[model samples]
Target: METRTVVAECIGTAMLVLFGVGSLVLAGDYINALGISLAFGFTLIAIAYAFGRISGCHINPAITLGVLLAKRIDIRRAATYWVAQLVGGIIGAAILFLLAKQVPRLQTAGAFGTNGYGGRSPVGLGAGGAFLAEVLLTFLLVFVFLTVTQKVALVGVEPIPVGLAYTAVNLIGIPLTWASVNPARSLGPALFAGGGALSQLWLFLVAPMVGGVLAAVVHRFTHQRPVGQAQQEQAAEPPRVGPWGRMRGGHRPEAGGPEAKGPEAA
Candidate 1:
């Protein structure tokens, strides 16, 4: 509930949509899909390093949901982050829309970098294909995020893998559904684009959330619990007595023993 954290999330999400979607809205003709994809990836890397300490730089509602489901953050914090991120995204898109309007002959009404399928899709992918593509693409991003941010992961280098995973998903997803792995990112531009973008918005929102949930479920099965969490869980359990009356299950290692030293002892 820290005010600064919420502000950071809002500012971070705004920067993401501004730079990532702005690259497309303003410079898609020059930079093309690869450049746009890199824009999104690089923006994420910068946000992660800059605000990762304060807010973890979720920026994306789907990512926040994944973190929440993983129990990394409580519901109150997650809801706060979601609101901040959505507001930030809309603010960013609004800024982009104004900038685009300044450019001569630039169109911001129909597309405006909004995600879509069917005719709006680069490859004309159908609704079902787009939904599946978004789910799988978002799954990869969320899964990488969950795995790389773990206690076992190398500190100070999580952004590299996460950004790279984002770039990879975008590379494959752009032609299909414009790579809407983040619902906040998609909703922002769609609000401005209106028309078909509004109608098709449901798929982008629902698919990413489903993917986040799946990522959390799979992450639980794949990664071991942090040592401190395991210890806490053990401490909370009632102690049991064996046949000989020795403490079992919830017993803690004797003080100064090797077992009592935890992972640091290794």
Candidate 2:
């Protein structure tokens, strides 16, 4: 694995939490829910463009898991990304925590932008409702990401749909469970919020992973691969491309296979 790729994942995931979650923690009262949703969407778009070339800019562990299941990236690489994203999320949350402390009378204890259910939920959504909501919400986000990135024709415009999908999920999920399509996003804030947030953290993590798996399975059936292509993709070293230029690793090559023109070739 390349060091730069890992670093990019770390930085990109940190930025996602810092700006996306930060908007809710710092400015939720002023910006409101829609603004917070936009914050996350906008941050994802920025990260996709900024680090897309280097790491495919997954940032979220759920996305990485989906990508791994799709055979886009190997398990070792996925594991590395997961670690990087978790660390980055914590780092971003720690920074957000410090900043929140600076504001007088600002509360960061119970909420801190963490996902939850029951009394912690905004609409009083129960545990079962929260779980189902997260699964469906995350399914939409991951499904969009997989669909957009897989098509060779949609290379440059991938971020738009993926980011919008994220925004859409947040819009619906905020009232239910504060929208935890990304586990790293939830874990970061919960660690600092402690107490109930920690207890409720499992749903955020497990549901997203389930959603990711479901997306991958559905994608396989929906987007059928060419006969023999699966074996080739598994055997050969796949080409890499920036998010704008070509499908990321584990995607069909631009021309067809490994010999297809890549970012460097272009």
Candidate 3:
């Protein structure tokens, strides 16, 4: 990958952790879990549009794994993204850790926005619930991305549904497991929060990957289109207005090309 691409991924991932985790740690008392979900979801929208063309804006390692399993990206590139994302997560958490120390209550609180289950969980959810939540939530997020970003339909406005999907999962999963769904996102804060956050970290990591792989399989069966057919469809279609006035390929004319003037020779 190009250096610029690597840097974009690094910066984008860092911002995700910075804003997403920061919202939960700093303003969580004020904004609550729903607001935190919007923070992460909106941050995803900003980064996806800002750096999406450069590196596909896969700030989450789980997303990268899903895309890799879908064969949308090669193994080597996926590895590079993983490294960049992990480093970015650490950097993001380090910054959050430093800032959190300034607050007297947060300093001793040791939250750092880490994810956990059972005693560590906000609602005392056990291992099984947290594991299931992570898997199901990650699966939905990845499946939406795989489906929405395709060339067939809703071509240009992928970021909207993709971001909304993240928000929806967070909205439901926050109280249960703090909405992990991304290993790097979880690992970064766990390093700082330690204790049970570190001990229960394995569940966050393993379940999300399993969910991503399952999403990839489901995407292949439900949404995958043959390359040649896709190309032919694109050629047959004409550029038309999509959401937000973006140009996207629309269906071809029923009988004639765009230049054809007569409607049934009337």
Candidate 4:
């Protein structure tokens, strides 16, 4: 990975956590679940425009893993992106921690937006339910991202659907698991929240990864060929004769139709 790309990933991920988690920790009560979900969704849209060109704006580790499994990125670059995203999440959480200390209510609040289940869950969902929620929600998010990004028609506005998907999943999964579709997003707050948050961090990590892999497998079957692959396939085909020969029109390359073969010439 290019140094600038890695730097962009770091900054983008940091911004995601800063705005997304910050909303949950600082203003969650005022705005409620809808507002928090919008906060994360809009943050992703903004970062996609800002850093999408530089690093494809994979601020979330799950997104990177999905792309990796689809063979869009090699393992080494994916590893680099994962490290940058994780570091960025920690840094963003640290900054939130420092800022929260100034506000007594925010500082006293539990978890600092960390994801959890059972007693820790906002809705008291059990571990099995939480895991299933994470997997299904993350799968939806990653699948939307992979498909929309590859769709030629959605070019420029690709981020919008991905952002909306994030918001929708959060709406459905928030009360259950706090909707940790991104492991890096979960890891940051868990490190500081400790206690139950730390103990349950593994679920956040494992479930989203599983979701990403499932999305990748589904994408591999349904995805259209990339431009390079399409071009290579076109090149490998036998040369055609007429304007619509060997494809639509039934004009064979014989009987002076185009390139008459020696079988006919002889």
RMSD of each: 8.1, 11.6, 7.4, 5.4
Task: Give the alpha carbon lDDT tens digit for every residue of 1-266 in model 1.
Answer: 67988998999998999999999899999999899999999999988888888888888888889899888889999999999999999999999888899999998888999999999999999999999999999999999999989631223989889999999998898888889999889999999999999999999989999999989889988895765998898889865655444445533334322233468644
Q: Give Cα distance to truth, residue 215, candidate 4, Å.
A: 0.5
Query: TM-score of every model?
Result: 0.84, 0.84, 0.82, 0.84
Q: Better model by lDDT, 1 or 4? A: 1
- Candidate 3 clashing pairs, residues 3+ apart or interchain: none
Q: For residues 197-219, what per-residue lDDT tens digits would candidate 4 score against the true structure?
A: 89999999999999998898888
TM-score of 1: 0.84
**Number of the candidate with higher TM-score, 2 or 3:** 2
Winning model by TM-score: 4
For candidate 3, lDDT tens digit of each residue in 6-63? 7877888889898998999999989998899999999998888888778888888888
- Per-residue error for 51 in candidate 2, Å, reads 0.5
Residue 161 error, candidate 4, Å: 0.9
User: Which stretches of candidate 3 lie above 4 Å from their native place?
Assistant: 108-110, 151-155, 226-266
Weakest 10 consecutive residues of candidate 1 by summed lDDT: 250-259
User: How does model 1 fare in lDDT?
Assistant: 0.88
Q: Which parts of model 2 are misplaced by more than 4 Å?
A: 151-155, 229-266
Question: What digit string (tens of lDDT, one per residue) describes model 2 on residues 1-266?
Answer: 78998998888888899899999999999999999999999999988888877888888898889889888888999999999999999998999999999999998887899999999999999999998898888888888888888631223778899999999998998888899989899999999999999999999999998999999889888986868998998889655675655556634455555534569654
lDDT of 1 at 213: 90
**Model 1 residue 83 lDDT score:** 94
